[model samples]
Target: MEKQRNVLQVNGLNVAVKSAQGMLPLVQNLQFELKPGKILGLVGESGSGKTITSMALLQLLNQKTMNVEGSIQLHGRELNGLKEKEMRGIRGKDIGFIMQNPMNAFTPVYTIGNQFVETIRIHTKLSKKQAIDLAIASLEKMNLQEPSKIMKMYPFQLSGGMLQRVMIAISMCLRPSVVIADEPTTALDVTTQLQVLRELDRLRTECGTAILLISHDLGVISELADEVAVMQKGRIVEKADVYRLFDHPQHDYTKKLLQARPVLSVNEELSKLVI
Candidate 1:
């Protein structure tokens, strides 16, 4: 088999916040690589620094009070010290992000189509009509019905699942090299969750987009991630291929996480756990 190239690499990543006491470390000495067309699952409990890590990669953290140290390389370009303008060009173009809350990703007042066209126009030189066409095409890729109709509806008028799918469509419309999906399926029903997961998998297969998927659900990780990193207390204790991580987890926290879920038969596929 051919080796896949690394689209994103993080080395010696540490995130700290200033408080009255002193600097409080949220993520410590994190290191990982995201390969093209593969999903890397970052699994951890709440407050384990999964979200902060992703934010740091995008340089989305506030520089005023937060201290981020180490290297974040996208396509071998260092991004830690880039200016906000430079980072803006990288974001949505080279690196797309899907936030945990779909509603928070968009302006409540704007129609979904308007936002989509604006986003595409910002990243590309496409005209308004061309951008709208692309947006509708991308939404159709998510299996969303009446893509044109979805564009006219305001965020509040759409269901949570619909909004989540639209968020994915927007993030992917640019066909970014790396996509940071932070809990993309959180708060959604089982069917919606499955649809979202399938869309993510399709992105990997169809577009060869590397995905850094952060989720608390082991089942979700098992279904989508090629490799899994088990994090606890802001540190990754174990890292392995998805099958190895599930069948032979090395860390106690990983073991406990598996035990916390319902029992599965030895012969069952990891995807079966989702249903």
Candidate 2:
């Protein structure tokens, strides 16, 4: 079989913000790629520049106050300087966003059905009824019982877990070639988080969707990432396969992160945590 090329390429990336005092670098010299049917984990704690990287790739930045330098190529096309109108076409249709908090991206005034239909209509040639049917079907795949009721309900009516699934469904409705899932499971309960991850795994396998999975949770990365990139202080400190990264981390930060994961069994936990 012929090898598929990179769907997203980021190189020489730098992001900085301007304040009253001076310039502050948020992400420095970051570089990576995502091929079809693979997941690249962007792992780091809060304010470590993980979210900034994704926004940079999609050209979603406040250009007036920020200084961004880099090349972000999606399907062989550069995205660095595209106009907002030009970027809009690609944002949802070619590249989907599963935000850390789904509610942050959702509108309080609209029903789930309204938002879903609007999203579908933006990227595809679909009528109101067509989009509505697709939305209901997508909700069903999330294992939501009485999916129709959820569709009629407003954003405030649903739990965080439910909203997360809705965001996933909305993002994938266009079958985007790449999905930027930023802390997608952060707000969910443990069991719900597992379910969401499993659903994402299924989506990746079944549809060959390229994923940029960003989170502070190493356990989440261990469960889904094909390759891991460890970030610290706005730069990638080390990167390796999940198992190798866990067993033999090169950087002190990476090593410290591994040490923080709780052991599963009580005996193992006791042994590892012995005073």
Candidate 3:
């Protein structure tokens, strides 16, 4: 089979924050590729630099306080040194972002419809009516009910899962080439998490959008990612195809992580085994 085209590439990526002591490296020499219609799962424990790496790729870090070095290419275009104005054009249009907290992503004061319309108009030449129509259509795609009514509600008025689904809809509305999802299923019930994951999987199939899924859960990675990269202490310790990584992890850290997964049966049958 022919190799798929790469939508995003990161090489020698590093992030360092200025501190009283000196520059502290948060992410070191990170590298990865996201291909069209493929998901790259970045998995690691908290403070392992996964989120920082994603932010660096998006050029969302503050340049003054945080020093980010290396190449971040989207469709072969360099994103490292682009001005804020130039980056703005690429953000929602070329690459969409689903933040960890859906509430943090929206303005509590604005109605969902109003925010969607503004986002759509900013990226495209759509009029208010056109944008509203598009927004409602996108919501429908997520299996959301009463799209028109939901649009009229403020972000605060909606449930967490509802807000998250709406956020996913907004991220995908423009059909961006890449979507950076940062712990998208965090703080959700298992059923809701599955729903969100399904929506993400659908985006990959329907829009052929590459995904950079950041999470600490190996199960989530195994479910959605084609390839996986394991990060620890600011560096990638292991990377491989999903099956290979799970079946035969090369690094000690990876092996430990796999072993750490809670075995429901083992715990439940512990008393029987002891007797």
Model 3 lDDT-worst window of ten: 266-275
What local lDDT does model 3 show for residue 191?
91
Model 3 lDDT tens row, 153-227? 999998889999999999999999999999999999899999999999999999999999999988899999999
Looking at model 1, the pairs that clash are: none
* Cα lDDT of model 1 by residue, 110-161, tens digit: 9999999999998999999999999999999999999999999999999999
lDDT of 1: 0.94
- Model 2 bad stretches (over 4 Å): 268-275
The candidate with the higher TM-score, 2 or 3, is: 3
What TM-score fits each model? 0.94, 0.94, 0.96
Which portions of model 1 miss their true places by more than 4 Å?
A: 264-275
Candidate 2 least-lDDT 10 residues: 261-270
Give the TM-score comparing model 1 with the true structure, all chains together: 0.94
Q: Residue 26 error for model 3, in Å?
A: 0.7
lDDT of 1 at 141: 93
Candidate RMSDs in Å, in order, are: 3.9, 2.8, 2.2
Q: Which candidate model has the greater lDDT, 1 or 2?
A: 1
